[model samples]
Target: MRDLDALDRRLIELLSREPRIGVLECSRRLGVARGTVQARLDRLQARGVIRGFGPDIDPAALGYTVTAFATLEIRQGRGRDVRAHLARIPEVLEMHTITGAGDMLCRIVARSNSDLQRVIDRVVDFDGIVRTSTVIALENPIPYRVLPLVTQDGKGLATPRDAARPQGEG
Candidate 1:
């Protein structure tokens, strides 16, 4: 995607803060025309920058209090099969191919420690999976966030628009 301009940055920041805010409200808050705000949103979506506006849900709130990451070693020539197997299990939140000792990594959740073992057992039940290693998360000191990355330049400094704004203003 193309680089985000000052207006784009500000608009994204505003939207990220108040996802339920209406387009007219966004225009008023960002000091832009409603049409401009809509057009920017359209372009951002078309460019795949804004993936979705779905509500963010915590697995813990759903009674799946246990969170763990599993690194899987798949059999040769079974990557696709292993992915399909993982996808069939609802507990597998996400999986990714990584460049490391393991072939794939998965983020999973469970109701408890014993439930996690059951999830792991199901994960490795597929013949395509060779072995698995998992680690449980004790506490999430810093949850997932992307606002900082959105305002960061390639050199790890804040963009001019973000820098000009005073701290805690956005």
Candidate 2:
């Protein structure tokens, strides 16, 4: 990933606060030329720094209220096949190859505790999956975010475009 400068950070912050705002509106708010904003957005996208501009969805709001993390123990030399099988399951939201007692960890969701058991059964039913231990999430006091990373100061470094940003925009 390219090192984000002050201008990039501010642009991200502004867009995150108002995702529906247009590039021209962003240019006006940031006090930079429209082309500058357009160029920066293009560069950021090309560099894969900006993934996508899509609506964030809450699974719980969509009838999946129960959330659990499952740690799986796999049979030797079956990681690839197991991961492929897991990819087909929509309830498997995220997966990571982990160290320690488990070979992989998966974040899963379901409608209820009983529903979670069914999900778990489907996960372990696959060949090469030995065992799984799961922990139900009671609540989430802090959700996932990347804003602090975007807004971090890079030891006083600022891009030329940062000069055009309004005071307190940082």
Score each candidate by Cα lDDT.
0.89, 0.87
lDDT of 1 by residue, 12-92 (tens): 888888889999999998888999999999999999888878898999999999999999999999999999999999999
Q: Under the 3 Å rule for N, CA and C atoms, how many clashes does model 2 have?
A: 0
- Candidate 2 minimal-lDDT segment of 10 residues: 161-170
| Alpha-carbon runs more than 4 Å astray in model 2 | 155-170
TM-score of every prediction relative to native? 0.91, 0.87
Q: Give candidate 2's root-mean-square deviation (CA, Å).
A: 5.1
Q: Name the lDDT value of residue 6 in candidate 1.
A: 70
Q: Judged by lDDT, which candidate is best?
A: 1
